[model samples]
Target: MMLSLFDQFMSPTFLGVPLIVLALTLPWLLFPIPSNRWLNNRFLTLQTWFIYRFVRQLFLPMHRSGHKWAVLLTSLMLFLITLNMLGLLPYSFTPTTQLSLNLGLAAPLWLATVLIGVRGQLVYSLAHLVPEGTPTLLIPVLVIIETISLLIRPLALGVRLTANLTAGHLLIQLISTATFVLVTTMPLVSFFTATLLVLLTILEIAVAMIQAYVFVLLLSLYLQENV
Candidate 1:
């Protein structure tokens, strides 16, 4: 019968297995592995160039020590963007839309950066909890506030990704349902709604890529501070 809009966000299952397992693994297979040949196919060439540019831009603001995270961050970006774009297609699930998945990805990486900061520069990391010119009475309060903010970064990262994707998907589903309902009784209105859907779809595609970039970019910024 009828499906709720939120139903689309549920992780699908086949037999006893979750399809999310496949969704998460599928993106990596879509990429072509680099061959030993001196020349590569156009797709591989373009892929390599795009990744090179992205890594260069992402790491430009960080110290040399932060460069070690290049591979992890780049892979994460591609993984996220692919998961997001794939979900836009018919009959596919987006793992990134799940809060648990997003937090699973965010928490450890964010923790790693914090740990690195603690390990490398403990005093500096502690200093971040308080500003230099804090009034005598406010130092403890500022430290507590800053501590809470620091702890919330990973939660914020996960929620930001989840909220953005969920909102876009819901909007798309709602508009498509309206367009479908209007097609019989109000063809002209349906046409305009359909056009709007097309434009939103395009915007969603850009949002998919941008959200992925923002996720990794913020992580890199955190790393830069630590390094």
Candidate 2:
């Protein structure tokens, strides 16, 4: 029986239970726990520095009101980066590659930011649906358009993350399969393909990290608008 290229994406199960739960939980264990001692090891120091810098840059433009989300956003960045990077490993399933999971993460956070804007500054929030200096005839049309755009934010977030990771993984798998097949009949060509595959894998690793940052960064931008 031939397996589909996409079979790699199927959620793994054992005894009828989804292994995604384990996949999701396992990454968290890899992070070093902070120790009680005042001094920290190099790894812990580096982790702390990265988090501090990321949080600072992410919220720099927003008012102090947005600062409250620093921890949530920072934690999300780490969670997503971990998931994305780990998925590159052989035989591992990536939960974030699922649109359902991505939407589940995006929708609630996007809605919360919208709700905060509505509750804290209802007039301002509603004002965003219509632009300043619009002609009278275009006001209603512009409002509807803006409202649709606002509603699509979460969908865009989910789709962007899902699509990028899916494409990268699919490409990697296709190239790898080709490399293995060519090794038997075309050793010379297979050598070059293998080299390309190695480079591609390195690129995928970078993409995984960047896509995670982009996801979190966009969320912070949405929060900035509200707060």
Candidate 3:
């Protein structure tokens, strides 16, 4: 039987058990644990360097209060990038493509930032609902607009990730399918299509990494507003 294009986004199952848990946990296994010795392999050294640079750059603009989030944000960035890159492999499932999983990740973190803002500076947080030097007539309208925008942050985060990944995957599948069909009917055209497919694959790889970074970077910005 022919499969639907969206079938790739569905969670795989075996023996009546869903494999999403395995997919989510698999990326961590690929990472090497820190060694006790001062010296380490090239791979470990590179990984450490990448993480150090990412954390330093990410937190450079934030206040000291936001420094505590370095570990959480760094881990999140690694987790997301791993899942995204791994999904590019043949026969692999991408959990982030699922809206539920993406929302699950976005909601709590976004809520935490809002809560932190309220707890630390309720007046400042509430002040965000109303901009400075606003006209009396527009005050209520602006407040409503700002509140809606504030509430939409998590939804935007989840949808942005899901839509981007889903679109890229669908495009790749469509092009590959077209290339396969053309291979037998039109060898010359198929060769060119296959070349296009390779370029698209490289673009998708960049998209995967970027989307992961953008996801976490937005979270940090939200935290910056609060902390």
Candidate 4:
């Protein structure tokens, strides 16, 4: 397991700093504000809707200043997501497929839940975790359930993102390798397998976007519940 961490850095840097920086700075460097805005409007039409929704979120009601946080979070999501999807393009690495990487993203969400709720009220977040209308004798049981639920958030995030990306990539890699072997011996096998792998690669790209959308939307919902 420790060696896997080292292996992660062997081909690509484990933290995805290069990819992330590229995504972050690309908007400023290559495509400056006007051009970036035009591209966002043209390519990502629905993202504007999300920005509006994030602003006008009824349950949470983030302030104008707080809107920047949503932009930052959403930017991070799209950045990582684009990088993840790019991995399907041969000789690339999917950073989000890593548990350590996903966990890094999840840890801040966990802390945000704690910090936001704590700022509002020390026990405010616990309100949802606790049973107000339940039997008093079940308090310990309820507390345990709450603890488990809180702990599960990060675990769920890590597993959900990592599993989807890793499985999809592994399937492609495995099938492609087998296809090459078959082609060398039988010649007829590679044609269909290679075609299928290409189709599956496209599907994997869609799944990458879906996973990113799911993670971000879930976090938005969580933020709504807390704030």
Give the alpha carbon lDDT tens digit for every residue of 1-227 in model 1. Answer: 44788989999999989999999999999999999999999999999999999999999888999899999999999999999999999989989999999999999999999999999999999999989999999999999999999999999999999999999999999999999999999999999999999999999999999999999998998998899
Colliding residue pairs in candidate 2: none
RMSD each, Å? 0.8, 1.0, 0.8, 5.0
Q: Could you tell which candidate, 3 or 4, scores higher by lDDT?
A: 3
Ten-residue stretch with the least lDDT total in model 2? 1-10
Residues 80-191, model 2: lDDT tens digits: 9999999999878989999999999999999999999988988988988888888999999999999999999999999999999999999998888899999999999999
lDDT of 1: 0.95
**TM-score of candidate 4 to 2 decimals:** 0.74
What lDDT score belongs to each candidate, Candidate 1 first? 0.95, 0.92, 0.95, 0.69
lDDT of 4 by residue, 93-115 (tens): 66676688789988787678667
* Tens-place lDDT digits, model 3, residues 100-216: 999999999999999999999999999999999999999999999999999999999999999999999999999999999999999999999999999999999999999999999
Residue 90 of model 2 has an lDDT of 88
Clashes of each: 0, 0, 0, 0
**In angstroms, how far off is 85's CA in candidate 4?**
1.6
* Two-way TM-score contest, 3 vs 4, winner: 3
Instruction: Return the candidate ranking by TM-score, descending.
Output: 3, 1, 2, 4
TM-score of candidate 1 against the unseen true structure: 0.98
